[model samples]
Target: MTDWWLWLYVASMAGGTMLFLAWWARPCGVPAIEYQVAVAVPVWSGLWYAVLALGDGRVTDPGGQSVSWARYADWTVSASLLLVALALTATHALPRRHPWLPTTLVGLNVTMIAAGLLADLSAGSRSRYLYFALGTVALLGIFAVIWGPLRSVARRQPDGLHHAYVEAAALLTLLWIGYPLIWLAGPSGAGLLGPTTDTALFVLLSIASKIGWGAFDLARLRGLARRHELALAGRP
Candidate 1:
């Protein structure tokens, strides 16, 4: 049962990586940094998912909880790239308070996920819930940064780009918020969702979040680049 889901996830990741790379390779005058980050996010995410699939979707922790450490590793790198892409897209609009604000936020977000993973691996039910609470707190902090500083920056982008940024952020946020709930329903929590359903839910979310968002961002960048080229050509 779960094997089918695992294979499907692997296939989707492979297909998505190919498609994303193809779009990424096309010529676009968008900032190289933005382009690189956009491409890297999904590519790396797919790679990690592939690794997870090879390992039969997840590993059982000491407490007999099914844990996807590969997914955590994926989030650590890919999530930071997602932020970097957002930051780069809004570079001109971001506040000048701190040069390393994006990097710091990325680190914090990765730490939050890592903490949650550790909590899921804990032996006792009480520890599981406690660490999960702590992870949730960290998630709230990350959200504050996004909805606060990041939103401010995004709002200053040009109309089309601003809309794109908002869409990307909204989609990513929606998928991410569900993750904690899924955790609660899985082996570590109430065990209501069983491994198969839990694995399926994650696969669907990963497709929507990483692959879908990457494609949208790539299209937005290409459109912006085209408009810029046209504007430059029309200049006196």
Candidate 2:
């Protein structure tokens, strides 16, 4: 399609690559990997929507009636992705450590995708609420399980999957929290989230997401030793 669409597709594919590579390299068993991918696939799938929506360059259609297929596809992908992401996060947080969190996340993610798809056919405010509610659920999950119990474990887990999860969660939360504030002051703040604004937000969110990934990976690489520990332990 257009350069912008191509750009979004390429960028989204890059994100997908990062996600898959990280998942593949995670220090977990086959079952865990499968479980992880179940959720991970959809999250990346949502990013697929990002590519499409960015390519189409409009949230609603020409009539401003409702989310177009292109736009709906974007939402579907996002809903699916977020669903899986949440599932994996919750599974990883299981009190019994049963590996159920990942499976649960996948289940929920699937349900969300289904709901989002069906919502595409709905009329009126119902559609809006579907999207809003999905977002709210994801936000809640992020706060409750990811930031709460998972954070401590994530920070301390050996320099791999665990660490990445923690860092990514923090980065995502921070960016999500900050993005709205930026939009409020930006030109697209007049109750209209334009393509430019969406692009800007997506760029920032992507940067934040990657920063989280990199920081954790770096921490793992460096053994995550603090300054004092490095000094006490002496230079390597």
Candidate 3:
């Protein structure tokens, strides 16, 4: 079941990658970096999905569960690109403080994924929950960065960037809440749900978070660019 679902997910991601690339290829006037980063999100995730689908992604966890380590790698990179796209869209992110806030956001995202991976890999319950707690903390840090400094940055921007950032961040944060919840209930944690159900939840979440969210973001930003309300982002 896992293999079958993973293969299906790989196909979905492949299709999403092609669609995202095609969208990016169009002469949208949005910032090239944002569009390009949006494209990279699915491309990278698709490749990792392919790796897992090929049956090379399984690792025997200390809990004797078959885990897909590649999924963690995929999340780390793809989610970071998502953050980059968000930062590029909503903030001037350059020529000041080395774009520390955006970098900090990405770092927090990576930390969250890494900790989740470590949690799954851990043998003992104490170690696993410890890592889970760390990941949750990192996730909170991400939210803080978003609602804190990133919000402040967004508010100062013109061209409807403030509203855009708030909406995008809200969507992303809402979607992200599912990950740890699913992980906690799935085989990796309490084992309240079976692996197949866990995979299904994750797959659905990935589809919505990556492809759906990316489309919404790029499309809205493109509309803003067309109206000449977009600033700081490079126009075609």
User: What order do you get sorting by lDDT, best first?
Assistant: 3, 1, 2
> What is candidate 3's local distance difference test score?
0.82
lDDT of model 3 at position 43? 80
The regions of model 3 sitting more than 4 angstroms off are 92-98, 229-236
TM-score of 3: 0.91
Give a tens-digit lDDT track for model 3, residues 150-171. 7877777774767777888899
Error of 3 at 202 (Å): 0.7
Error of 3 at 71 (Å): 0.5
How close to the true structure is residue 134 of candidate 3, measured as C-alpha lDDT? 99
Residue 104 lDDT (model 3) = 96
- Estimate, for each residue in 1-236, the C-alpha lDDT of model 2 and write its tens digit: 33454355446546655665665575333234333443354355445545554555335433253333543344344434443453344334333443444344444444544444344344545564565467446545545655665555444544455654665566556655654344333332334665455555655464444334333433333343344356677855
- Candidate number achieving the greatest lDDT relative to the actual structure: 3
lDDT score, candidate 1, position 154 = 73
Better of 1 and 2 by TM-score: 1
What lDDT does each candidate get? 0.74, 0.46, 0.82
Clashes of 3: 0
lDDT of 1: 0.74
